[model samples]
Target: MNIPSDLKYTKSHEWIRVEGNVGTAGITDFAQQELGDIVFVEAPAQGSAVAAGAPMGSVESVKAVSEINAPASGTVSAVNADLTDHPELLNADPYGKGWILKITFANTGELSGLMDAAAYAAYVAESAH
Candidate 1:
């Protein structure tokens, strides 16, 4: 529910913090809450080339397993190595220390389809009902 105004969102519940052509991606706080206690994460390899809407990795929670999709087309520039040792970071600090991926731009046009924070909040609210 802590959707920061500066970020954009994907329908799959991932948040993208764009900084020029590079971006930081993470699961939204609302997403982690719904998924429950996270136990493990499958992160993309460093330098992996990923496409928009592709399955970059997956997360395992106490309740179920969920795939984490790319918010936009890009190459995976970095992976948060800490998650392999502490997947609970997704629940504890989803927006900060728990960021899932750092990607370099491949398609700027894909960004037009992403939702702003306000729009995404409304989208989640409607879907929750």
Candidate 2:
């Protein structure tokens, strides 16, 4: 499980990297591993409003289809168009080029509700057992 220490995580398996009021989000390494061989991504459009914990889009894999949730409330500023062509990037590098959405969040305070890397790791471990 390549859980980066700098990102915040949701129980649903989304991770967010906050920079000022902007956040970039994607499914964690654990999620991609479980989903298996991502084939398609339905990304939210730019300027779309998404609420924290709400489904913004979906990812299709050889194993299953999984909803991608918003980790914070915000207007989506960008979507990774690259995923449309190369969904494998998600499994290959989820934290970097595989980011699904960039959001300009309304309240940075909402981030405190998300789990830090340590807590998320524990959560994943606990869920596994």
Candidate 3:
């Protein structure tokens, strides 16, 4: 579980990297490993509103289809179109080329409630037990 110190995490497995007023969102490494061999991804259209904890997109793997929820609220600014054609990138690089969406946050203050690397690592560990 590689949780970067710079990002905040959601209990649902989404990670948010806030840069200025924009945020890059993706599934955590633990999430990708669990999903297994991602085959497809469905992302929200640009400029669409996304509410915190709500479904932002979906990821389909050999095991099952899982919804990728919003880690925070915002208007979706961009989606990684590469995933539509090469979904395996998610399994190969869950934190990099696999990033799902970029959003312009509705309220930066809401970031205070998100988990840090330590907390998210603990959450992952506890869930495994």
Candidate 4:
């Protein structure tokens, strides 16, 4: 899996790149591989308040529909409108253009609970068995 070392990961397989108090997030490479070809992404509305670990949106793949959970609490500042036209981006470049939403964090302290790239890679390995 392409787990970039700079990002933080959640047990649910989402990854977030934090910049200041804002965070850009998306499903991990491991998640996209498991989901198969992504067909649709239901991103959370802009300006919505989301709590840490809560269901924020859903991604529908050829194989199944999966709920995407928030990695941290914040107000959603933006949603990637491109996904509405090209959900394949999630499978093609999940860590880059496939980002689902950007949030202005409510509490940066919650970041301490997230895993670094190495930890997440190990977690994925453990789960595979």
Candidate 5:
């Protein structure tokens, strides 16, 4: 439940931190918690093109495997290589060291479609029942 106010959130439980035209994407703290103990992360290759809402990677947990979607259309500039060997970081610090990918987005305007921290918190709360 560590929803940082500055980040944008997708309904699927991904968060994006945009800086200039580059966006850092990751599963939300709520997502990591729901997935349980993360055992593996399969990230898209660097330079890959991903569309908004498309699966860019996947995370495997002790309980189940879940797809990680892109929050906006972009060319993936980097992948969090550290997660391949240390998937537990997703559970340890999802918002910081556990961030999954960085993309050079085609349009910053698409960001308006995402939720802010307050809206996302309410969305998560409503989904709980």
Candidate 6:
């Protein structure tokens, strides 16, 4: 429900904060709440190519395991290693420390396909009904 205004969102509930040509991405607050308590996470290796809308990682929760899709095409520049030890961080701070990947863009234009905060909030609202 906490959709930050500055970041772009995916229909699948992922969020990306763009800084220059790099983007830091993670599941949205709405996603973590829906997934329940996160128990484990897996991210793409550094330097790996991630195509937009493809699986870039996964999150395991008490309820189920969910594949995390990429919001844009890029090469993964960094992956959060801390997730191996403390997956609960995804539940605790999904937008901050819980970020999964830092990717250097393959095409920044793909960002135009993503939703803004207001649209995502509205999408979540409509999906609930």
Model 1 segments beyond 4 Å from truth? none
Better of 3 and 4 by TM-score: 4
Question: What TM-score goes with each of the models?
Answer: 0.97, 0.98, 0.97, 0.99, 0.98, 0.98
The per-model lDDT (C-alpha) reads 0.93, 0.95, 0.92, 0.96, 0.94, 0.94
Worst 10 residues of 6 by lDDT: 54-63
Instruction: Give lDDT for model 5.
Output: 0.94
Mark the regions of model 3 whose C-alpha exceeds 4 Å error after superposition. Answer: none
Candidate 5 residue-wise lDDT, 45-115, digit = tens: 99989999988889999989999889999899999989988999999999999999999999999999999
Q: Pick the candidate with the highest TM-score.
A: 4
Q: For residues 28-107, what per-residue lDDT tens digits would candidate 6 score against the true structure?
A: 99999999999999999999999999998899998899999999999999999999999999999999999998989999
Least well predicted 10-residue stretch by lDDT in candidate 1? 47-56
Model 6 lDDT on a 0 to 1 scale: 0.94
Task: Compute the lDDT for candidate 1.
Answer: 0.93
lDDT of 2 by residue, 7-38 (tens): 99999999999999999999999999999999
Name model 5 segments beyond 4 Å from true. Answer: none
Clash count per candidate: 0, 0, 0, 0, 0, 0
Which model scores highest in lDDT? Answer: 4
Evaluated at residue 56, the lDDT of candidate 4 is 94
Misplaced by over 4 Å in model 2 are none
Model 1 TM-score relative to the real fold: 0.97
Task: Look at candidate 5 and tell me the lDDT of residue 22.
Answer: 99
lDDT of 3 by residue, 77-111 (tens): 99999999999998888889999999899999998
